[model samples]
Target chain A: MTAYDPARRPRVAVLCSFNVDLVHGPLSEALAARGLPSELYFSGYGQWESDLHNSASELYRFGPQVVVVYPDLRDVVPAFGSTVPSKHEAEAAGAEAASALGQGIETFLSRAPGATVLCTGLTVPPVNALGLLEGNAGYSWRSAANAFNAHIQDLSEGQGRLFFLDIEPVIQRVGWTAWNDSRLWCIGRMRLARDAYPHLAAFWARAIRAMLTPRRKCLVLDLDNTLWGGVVGEDGLDGIQLGHSGAGLAFLEFQRAVKTLPARGVLLAVCSKNNRDDALEVFRAHPSMVLEASDFTAMEIGWDDKATGLRRIADRVGIGLDSLVFWDDSPVERALVRRALPEVLVPEVPEDPALHAEFLHGLEAFDTLTLTREDIRRSAMYREEAQRKTVRAAMAEGPPEAFYRACGIEMTVVRADDFSLPRLSQMVMKTNQFNMSTKRYSTAEIAAFMRAPDIDVHALRVSDRFGDLGIVGMAIVRRDTSPWLLDTFLLSCRALGRTIEHGFLGFLSRRATSAGAGLRALYIPTARNAPVKRFLDELGLEPVPAGGETFHVTIPSGLVAIPSWLTLTIEE
Target chain B: MSDKLLYETVARVLRVPLETIDIDSSPETIARWDSMAQVALMLEVESVFSVRLHSDSLMALNSVRKIRDALVHLGALPEAP
Candidate 1:
């Protein structure tokens, strides 16, 4: 609904060892197809080293948020093409090249702390001195390239913003002959064919988009031919084909692939037009079923239309419908859902079951830049939410405070540090309903706030009898003003409905009172943030008439009190 | 391929006006048809005609007439056309 703003999109800079200026056109086209139009800057030919080391270089002046570093192995180690190098020489060349590139990247990171650097692994030269036996040769060009890539991979381990994109798989997918254009290389130093740039650029564009946008949280799958070989209700559990051999093996491979998604914080749910009992029987009795019934966060196995089923699944999981990717094998059902709910991503299901798993691999919806502890434990948190909801429903007979007291709610507030920056930035970008001000601050901006003397950024973690909700809320306060200004305040949707919002505000009020400052928070209304207005009114902060888009309120020091039932912990 | 289609493809790849190009146009004649545009032109030619250009003639196909002659020599286009 918002107008397209090119300046707001992510700025990308490419620094390659070869003439890859041709990539700019196709790379922009690929990103535009993903609905993320980016501003791209290409460094001059073979000027990566100068652009990285010099702080006043044009690359730094461009102020890129994402930098792609592509250094070809043949360009870095020229001797690999002419002579069959020894093991010691190959390893030395690889190490020296990696170290130099790594040093330049480290310098670039120092200049742009918030920028993400995607350094590529070296691709093996298609032709080498050793010919067909090169891979078997102990210290051939392949090993040298591997050594360089391994070192590049190691550089990204501790560096939070640095990522290593392996290009070998892409080259292998497109084939070496088609990927490289010897004629173009000889004519204009263009190492890649004109058409091959888009295939390689899609991966980079996805990674950049992940850094800026919230990732899809759930994958809604259909039953029958989609999940397995046959319909459960019609064919019966025994007749369904799913195992480690024949056509069943392909279904098993797809199931195994879906099962791994949960580990990466992607919830799996079922939306099928089958009897509930029949589907449950297959999940419980099937010996070769890779995904158990317990793995699903929610399931809608009824005779309802898939559009309605998908809505219920999204509601039960507390995620937006736009965050759900529906996979159905039937063209009729896929077309119906596409017409009914266009926001839901419906990837074309391959008719051949053998290609199903491969089709799943090409999905870019769930791509992310980093994997945090909170991400790995997200599914478990959702499972715990279901239990908490059941308990809350039973306690509905009593007053709201009774439920809060019975749950033994505990809240922890800590100053934002390097350890909590990634999750904190993610919460800032994704949390919408309880968010006030709704400013999408990047990790670098949050770090800048942390370094400022007058600004204090706090990360709130909630836990109870259910489980530990890791860093579910955050607030940024500017202390230079008379009444400390709350620049940003938000709580994760999963942590809501538990009165944690009240406790979080009380913690902030107490912190301000201790510093002899009253708190003034802004409640900026967004399309999805109408729920945040009532919470501010309940705290009884008198509104200070503001002329701008935000509704400003002044919080009295002793007015907002922390409830006795809620235990509060403050970490230094 | 028709001469009109060839000139249109060259103009589009070079990002110039169609009225500015003819059979005698070359890199020296058009400012936009630099080394980069030449590479892009070769690629567009290969894809448009569905024929691969030999590596030896990649640099030699400078003028529009020469490219047409090479395509004819490869039997990609009729000699008279």
Candidate 2:
């Protein structure tokens, strides 16, 4: 289980209709298990306005960190005998509905500026209503849903507070009849049958979890039919279908999908069964290849088995294999890789090639909590790191310290401000492996802490002969009676193994000594935070054998001199 | 189900002690009975009883006593003492 602070529960307001959701039970159970507290407000049967207003008020009063509004499908269902609206009319109706919904959201946010709102588009109903099927209304209903979703996404992006949870793809994946059979919907009667509710609840729970969690940092992909239409070994570079025609378009779209991952800070790497030359030739020569060889941080293209290739990719990138998701077209190959590296996620590919686009979109497991400046420049950063490794490996007969000195590694520690606060909070939330406490905080909470009189928050930025590491580390200390409590101490794993942790702690010690604090108290061990635990032990913080999750260490006024290799600059 | 299993499920969902809960406890009586806790308690009851509680019934299961009545109504537990 992820470590959660019981005192700081993230309040969530769920604004949706109460008619019937088939899977509410499992979803509620899942949220409870994860320690997320949520409140639900239902609009009385078929009363959209009442539901929206009531939900808005509930959310405002609760001052929730996130408000999820699931529009009632039954209320949105057109009158039983109404004629199907033309495309223009349907679009107009959709625009009108979106405006109304947006207004309601604006009103709610005016009351609670700190809250983040998420609006889920109307899910595909299990049964096409009689009015919908008659007079080409089915397509119109879908169009209206799409229009509403687009408007919500636009509003969210504009306000920087709204998030649209696209539930359509999930519904399409399970299919309408199968979903109804599985008891995932309430349909016309506004009630779910008892047997089907748990599964329905599980679906919602999974969707919510995906939305709230931070996305994986790396995407490990397989070649052959997965990236291109055919194996490069079998078809050769010229013979492969990858550009402007039939199966080629599918491969083209897949390339486009892989390209976007890098833009979102998900480092792309290839794990395939092919000659390196052949793969390179395709990447260079293929006109349809939207993804250039430059896009990938590392490429493991060889006749070597995929499992070995995956391991090599992990080694080259210096990220855990568990953080990667592998994509492949062949089930046999996927199974082989999965069996070899069980920690790596290998999702099943849809049988139909047409569904590939939808499959790629439904991968919300890799969606990010928030985008930062570092995220925008991540690919270039990884490329630079790779270059740094090559430079170090090539240098022979030089002292390690001399080599580091020659490279000129410098760190700048800046005091927290509004501009850097979001990135700082992001590091605190996502930096799990190297984190001491594994503390996760909402942006509002972080902002409040920065404003508090007794708290000191510091942001660390690193740059070397190669490039800048952006804002990579953060430390939060609270002044207490005896010691400055280390409320949060975390650094990105990319900055680890370089003694950046030691430099950060050294700086913290200097600051504590200057402030007349005697000790640094740190919260102790979690499964993912062993690296920090080891670091603390190395720093001579005697671990008291207490059974719970707290650790204390008294730092002498004079500890160790700040390492000369780390040239540190402080900014107030 | 045994009272022990039932109370354990509730405790696990609430992240509290099994001993702290009793048959008379409900949303109104339990200090932790906010909307979120109410939802969690209902989910716990459903899993422990292995029976689905309708959304309406879940709304009504505010107290431990009310939840016990719901369990009996759903044939998940015998009539309460």
Candidate 3:
């Protein structure tokens, strides 16, 4: 782990509805433990509103990359939490509270356009105004809080950068009794208990890590006693426990949890020491199985060691070994993988099966801040890539161009618009290998670039005979410079082997030629970006004599041609 | 536990040297013992000694001696002879 460097850490501003200073120390420790050492700025007690509304406030002066706007129900809807308001009043109060907070958030976002605001949902107070009748009552504090949370979700519908932190699960995990401290609340306005501060801080740190860091790509699982209650090799298909009742229900719940991960872009892979036919039979014949054969991108069901299986999965999924998270019920197998592949993240599996689902949810390795169209379909895209691989392997003797041409690659180049901004920003942040001068621009910065008259922000959406790989490449060019400077040029690793990089560059070169300007790009060498230099060399670029890692290439007007097989469409 | 452990916890929480946290150390003597630090110090004391302080004891816990007395009352430490 790297030591904490104050200058390099992201600035985080925590604004709470109550005295949240107790979390400052724990939040620092939590973030540092997660390998994201960040500088924290806390607003005065109950000053979240003023800090958000006032442009000249200290929060704006702090200029945080992430701001946590945490509101308590006691502060937002006092009537719902304390007084026995009528149903109409409770409903109205919830709406009014959400509306005011939404407006303040809008003001803050407009003022601090580059910061990602993490607003929390109001937690239902343990003691409702209506007491035990709160459920049957038309609308109580619980209802009001629910309405407030729903409205917060509604407010974040179109705002890609505004993330709503759902704190209900955290409260449940910590227990309401342990989370709230009435004594401290009365004495110092500290609403959260001392014991709960670390848990809450850990949760917040997970959100921060998701927003700012690269997420783990895949979860590799062992089959026997892990996904199912019994070992399939010994117990056979019918004997394995994975049904709605008995001990099998726990396994069913765990499978259901794992099934939801693919929708969030975490690929699933199987690494089990069992017959491959038995695993396939379970998937095909078992009626209680929540996951299908197609759900997993890679299936390594053999007698090989777990470390080799994990490496094969990473290779098959086109990700790094560090991006793989392995989980197995057998401690021996987990220890083996941990010792052999230190880069792989292997979390401890609880002895009890009932805790597996909760344990999986507790792991922050699969958390992602944004879910784009590409992310939602990432598993299916990898499956498609597997098919493409098979086609290439069948035609092993053919030239690389012939293989690429057979895939019927199509590139749709468009100027960065509001719809494409999120994917463009994500590519700028996450694309490392194929990036030339990796400059991570926020969504606001990319939007500003789109509006700048002297700058061009282009996004590439690629599709093939298989499926659409949404927004795979992006480039930011400074048109004001003499030689048009390529401020950012990156392509997704998934779309690398094809000639998409060349097609993307050819499109940019043609545009530069039309403007009567040469193209100059900088390849700042990073540990993971040696592939970018190869791409530059293939383009016949020469480094300028200024000693900086700069490449300048003059495009002869109408000379640079996009690959003939690639169907190109440009949208202004 | 030991008197040294209590002083160590206070010193660690307040980010001061252990030698600075004596029995007479109070908010008046320590610069960082403001309202926020006071609450944090009490939380640290509760966690370190595994004892909950009453509201009265919490309010009166301004000095290291008072904190030790509160711990003694809660049966986390032996009473003074």
Candidate 4:
């Protein structure tokens, strides 16, 4: 299936404390705001406890990719009254409440280990107790909430797939008095304010997008008002608003915000309709400029239209337009790019430059929930790809084989373990084009495979002089008898043309021969598996072409040749 | 103004058209105004009028007129609009 297919939008289960009737409407709108779609399933009101414990419950039946457990103050408290209960009674109730909630969370994780769980912390009311003696009481409303939220945070740290969403910060941002409307709570049992739905939706959507959707990899910026307060071509380096002083601090703050993206593997590029030398001067000469020339992965600074510039940046970065996010202060340029390149995300910069930093922070577009080791080094990987391209450009026209040989590509095949299993399974699920047998397995299932005696699972880590692309391929072999069957085999698209698959198959063949069995790899013909289809045939395997999916090479018979460009090493 | 406003709030809470509601509509006649809807309607009316209905009055919210009369007794509704 093509990337960004609507049907593949991550499935999310919103197990809410209140009636999710009104909240569901804004949840969809929040996803639309980020261009991430979700198939949301709402559990019955307050069924989070039952759904978490029962395997046959709706939570398991729906099989959501992400579960958002949102609880309000009303959900935990059976009754609300202005008259405060005695200090002794309050203490008893608080301990009981925390235990029940903690137990429910523990049971849910035991049943659902692979699915991501994002639980919202309880929001403390503006006034916890009646008069002002809440501080004197040991089990005050605030204290109870603090204990419960802290427990959730601890549970999140303990559990492999759990995160505590601190709703208190959001409430404080909009003021608790304004956020907790007395009208909606008393009248409709709608604990969360209707007006606050948009904010809550936007907040939770960032987390859901991060967990389920691929984040924007490349952030394309305009040099004029985007990177600085004024157009660099006209303002010149010293004159541009990018320093510690008034009006200039705003651009400095904006530059500081842009610098954080690269650390998280978001590639930074400059696309502007200005002289390249003029833009370079700011990055070079400006003492206060937080960004530098080396910081940007690519630069397309010229008088060309932004759409064309964005295309060149995308091409240079080796990513598609859909993965690029364009930031420009000019509304006309943003509008033109929006109309021309509909795939690219061009967020509108505030008219006032002072709000630009806050605007970028509010977007929350480029971040995700889980950051793997591969993800942290992704920007460097693309820069390496750019380096490879430069080398290709410098090579006085020859066969591409000489370039591949000189690149010093190496592959290490190792057995799957706890550390590498997550990436291995993720590659199995996300990699589409180069996959021979498009088998998708969860981390839990991969663990099961690792435990099984007859099944062998191996993953490959490839690297070159430029950088390392960690754990980009996975292979699962079922070795019960002679002619061992290839259960699941796939390589990431990034490692495809480099012929890492040859080393992968060669390693599997050696293992099969050592086990005193013949080697057989199967290719279930899929629309995207054409590349694999050709490689499987050329491996010198006996083609049982008449069947649906069969190719076998007996030991001392099947041709197993490792490419000279790649140094293959098998790890214990 | 408060009388008309009270009727509009009840209609909205019950998910019924304003024209379809009056002082006589109760849970027995309105299919959607079940136990949960009754609690919702009473909460909404109490919030709109800035007056809390008694726990006993929760079951007595049988008809729109009864609700109006309770609001009037609580001095929440203006004198007969």
Candidate 5:
């Protein structure tokens, strides 16, 4: 996914209006010129209803790693018509339209839960009505377009399935007249002409890539010669050069940068080639050591191969090797780790220690789309995982099931509230490996759903003898007259292989049935969510394709027994 | 400029064979005309010609002709494109 290879095209699904993009010509050409392989699903121009369903199907079939929806002309007709309703009425209409569209999107996403969907927020059309009515139409159109974009943003947040690409800043920078000449917009006579706009295309492509790819979770650091000017073992812990003066200041700035990552949700770990006792003493005793023992989730301080040390750190923290970025001054150690774990990213350390700060900042390999609560608590989670391993090892004398049961695992399912909103939104945004709808949401939008009467959302918290996994799973439901639509269902990657999702859904279905809901229609069959696509099928729920990736199931009112392995309780 | 200097700059930028570059060579003329190579080329040109190119100029300098024109504008080359 690096910008190096042209042939390594990411499968992209373009879901937007099928119209003449007169102004956005350059954008279109730029995408084409890059040789970016894409499947364009045009919602017929001015035909919102048909386009919505068609686009959904296209999204499912294409199963693109990234979904880019251009809302250039989709909202214009509804915005400009004389019969357009007031804000409240328009909101109600938008909600209805969104729900219907969501069903199709849900189906598509269920089939390709790992794909990152990018929705280009509505663009202002170049139709100025100055001659028509003193430019009142232009003003009205801009106002309406603003409202439409807001709704799209809300929908993106609520469904957790869309990334809002706001082109306003880029459009403003280019300006209207300049933008017109720049081929960012189509003007008179040309109508739907498209010109090649490489700059804007590059911006959009970079943004999309940043959103889809996972950033490095853990930074494995070497302390001696790398973090400071000298080896702690040879120079003595107190004698190391690290502080606000000379070569020490450079290390200090690097420490500051590494420390900031944890706040930004990047966990720090240490894998130093030094005696365990000496390294620990240096970390504890050094006055200039801004990064302490507590900063790292795990540390491997020994003369073991750097590759072996990184493996131990990764295993202890319960993360894949690929998710780690190793930093070492020794090229030999770096090369060894690179050979053993080619997936692990090892950026080159500059010869001059003073240039470390600039080198670290210049590395774009660890960039992510958005930071969520999971990121903030990632270090803590890894710490808990390490503790869990020790506890499990102690209890390993008996059968695994006995040890797990003895851990006093208790599950709690509660309707999502402000307290659990961050975690729930995080599960939607970042949980890729075990997600049913690779949907992403914002804190504000998830809060809005909690306030909505028609939507039912639940968050699950699992606690064991070791520690509490605070709000690890979430499910959002939209109630229609006849059936309850499972809008979104996702669990953290750590909670996988536990049958927690199945248990959670069983509990949810029972609750829904008790609430007088008869049918449970799940929009499933995403590429990355196959684990749950046949979930209802295994439950004896007959699945019939309702066009696209949606499935309708009629649930019997009988009390279905949840998996015995799961010990469940409900929280109000 | 001698072929040696041009080849050195091209090889450093492309990280490819010095033998692959010629006076008439362009991004399209080379096998590594990917996004990364484009960026590397821009960086190399900046270093070799000692000239800062604007975003538009960077976009325009895909071909050797365009690069020659840019170098002339930056006074790194003498009246030739």
Candidate 6:
């Protein structure tokens, strides 16, 4: 389990339109529970505008990585509690209020010093002029709030690092009355009830944790009651209520949802306590089964306990148990997995079959902020690796170096263009293990850097005989004469340990030397980036200030000796 | 007994000990009773007592006695108090 690190977890500032002293306790408690202890900067009530505009405000002084703005409808919208307005008047007022919100978010972003801002959606008052009729059409309080939320969504859609958390769903779950306590509001002018702090703060905390940790690589699933209605072995393949009708719709929908996981880069695995043949029969011959046998990345079916099966699946996938989520409808199986592998996220599936699809859809644990080409092809890449493993095992050599050399690896290095921008940015965002500087960049930022005359972005592609590992590496260099600075250099974990980074650095060194400036890089040590740090230090890059992070390596203007195994090509 | 609950509630919100909170211990005296903690204490008092404090009483609720007096005036005293 990832332990809470108060100093390292990104700092977040909560700037609200109301007093938030009651919030810090539960918010801290929730964040601590998730292994992300926050160093919070809570602005005083009604100081949001000043916190954003005033350069010397505590918000900027804290230099937080995330700023969660809690804007209540009473303040952000017009006539929130005042006299009800006509439909036209309400619609116009909603537009104006939404624009003001956009402007506020823009102002906060401008002054935030590179912090991502999460503006919570405005809560629509249930008992408005139109009441339930407002949801049907026209401008009621609900429609007006929806309009504001739509505009908020528009702002985030065009830009990176901006998001609008739809607190409406949370409101729907918790109910408006409980979410907003009248007694607390009357006493202290707090936006939400004292107890609602954890629920509200959880939205921001989840987003932040997703940003900090790499996404869970695999999803370990259970068959029988989890995938479909009834046990496969007991019910038999013909009796399974998968795609028949009515109640079977729930099972079919759940199957479809599980099938869709792999497309989003979540590898699937089956861990069932049923007979292997009985389970495979459903995927093989059952016409109603939405998931095919090929959909699963690994399988550990039979009479074994789900706990052992999950470990086997994780081991087979070459990912840690922490990087897996187990879904089992049976509480007994779920309990066993939880006890044996507590690190595995075992979400409680709703008891009612009808709620299964909704329960699966509501899982924010699988939320990934960005997607890349590498992500799209990740499942195929893993499948191809299985083939490579078989070939390696058949060969005389058992070592990786011999296998890599024998595979006839080919490499291509090119400047990041339209074709490579998405993957390059994704590598920057998610690649932590082999990254020299753990800096995340959006596609827009990567495009901006590429357009700059002083910056050069290198996108690398490597392929062995088994398959081409798509754009797997990136090296960004700030090219100024006399001392070119290596801004961010990273390679995916898939292509590490082959002296590929050495070739990447050598390529950069030659490029820098030709431009009359040699290569200079800095290795800021992080918990995950030790591989890059060790590589840079061992490659004889002398530390400029002797034990400092800044390193300089001189490259003679000649053909730098890359590894003999790699058939390298450098595209302009 | 109600006064003890009030003291304990205040202490809980401020993250201090129950014994540390006394009748005369105001924001001026308690280190945790800053502007931020004042808001926490106000809401907690309202929730615990189920009394909606008037704006003046809320602002004036600086010390333990002031809170107790305001709750008593509202007749929203706890079961023990």
Best by TM-score: 1
Model 5 lDDT on a 0 to 1 scale:
0.66
Model 5, span A1-572: residue lDDT tens: 22323455566555555332322434455456434443344333444334335645444555567666654433434443444344455445444444555555555556666665666665554644322342243333444455556666776676566667777776665655544332111211122212123445655665664664566788899988877878877988778889999999989888877877788777888998888898889777878888888889988888888888988988877889988999999989888888999989999889788888778765656666566766777777777776767777897787676655666667898988877876677678777655655656787888888899988888989977666777888888888556677777788767765567667877877878878875465555666776665555567767677677666565566634576767899876
Candidate 6 lDDT (Cα, 0 to 1): 0.77
Clashing pairs in 6: B2-B81
* lDDT tens per residue, model 4, A400-494: 77888878999998989988977887787888888877877888899999999999888899998878878888888988856898877899888
Chain A TM-score, prediction 6 = 0.70
Q: Where in model 2 is the C-alpha error above 4 Å?
A: A1-43, A46-117, A121-162, A166-206, A212-218, A229-231, A246-249, A284-288, A311-323, A338-359, A362-380, A405-410, A422-456, A474-493, A496-571, B1-81
CAPRI-style docking class of model 2 based on DockQ: incorrect
CA lDDT of A554 in candidate 5?
58
lDDT per residue for candidate 1 within A1-572, as digits (tens), equals: 01234568878899999999988888998788888888899999879777999999999999988899999887888786777777767878888899999999999998897688899889777776777766565656677777888898888997877889987888898888889998887877888876688887887787777766778889999879877899888888889999889889999999988988988888889999998999999888999988888788999999999999999998888889999999999999999999999989998888999999878867889987677787788888888787788888999899988988888999999999998998898899898899989999988999999999999999998899988888899999999898899989899987888778888888888888898888899777889997788887776655566777767888887787788889999996
Q: Least lDDT summed over 10 consecutive residues: which range in candidate 5 chain A? A: A184-193
Between candidates 2 and 6, name the one with more favorable DockQ.
6
Interface RMSD of 6: 3.7
Error of 2 at A248 (Å): 4.1
Clashes of each: 0, 8, 0, 3, 19, 1
lDDT of 3 by residue, A1-572 (tens): 01223468888999899999889888999999988888899998768888989988999999888889899888988765557876667777888898899889888887777887888888777776587767665656666777787887887876756888999998998898889888898888888888899999998999888888788989998888988988787899999999998789999999999999998989999999999998889999999999998899999999999898888888877799999999998889989999999999999888999989999987889887677777788899888888898999988997988988889998999888988886787788899999888878888999999999999999999999988888889999999997898888899898998888888888998888777897776557788888887876776665554366554444444545798999999987
Q: Give the CAPRI rating of model 5.
A: incorrect
Better of 2 and 5 by DockQ: 5
Superior by TM-score: candidate 5 or candidate 6:
6
Q: Rank the candidates by TM-score, best first.
A: 1, 3, 4, 6, 2, 5
Q: Show model 5 residue runs off by greater than 4 Å.
A: A1-205, A388-460, A463-467, A472-570, B1-81
> DockQ for model 6?
0.29
**Alpha-carbon deviation at A265 in model 6, angstroms:** 3.1
lDDT of 2 by residue, A73-134 (tens): 44454531254555556666666777888888877766666666777786545455434453
Error of 3 at A286 (Å): 4.0
Model 5, residue A325: displacement in angstroms? Answer: 1.2
Q: In terms of lDDT, which candidate is strongest?
A: 1
The A-chain TM-scores of all the candidates are: 0.78, 0.61, 0.77, 0.76, 0.51, 0.70
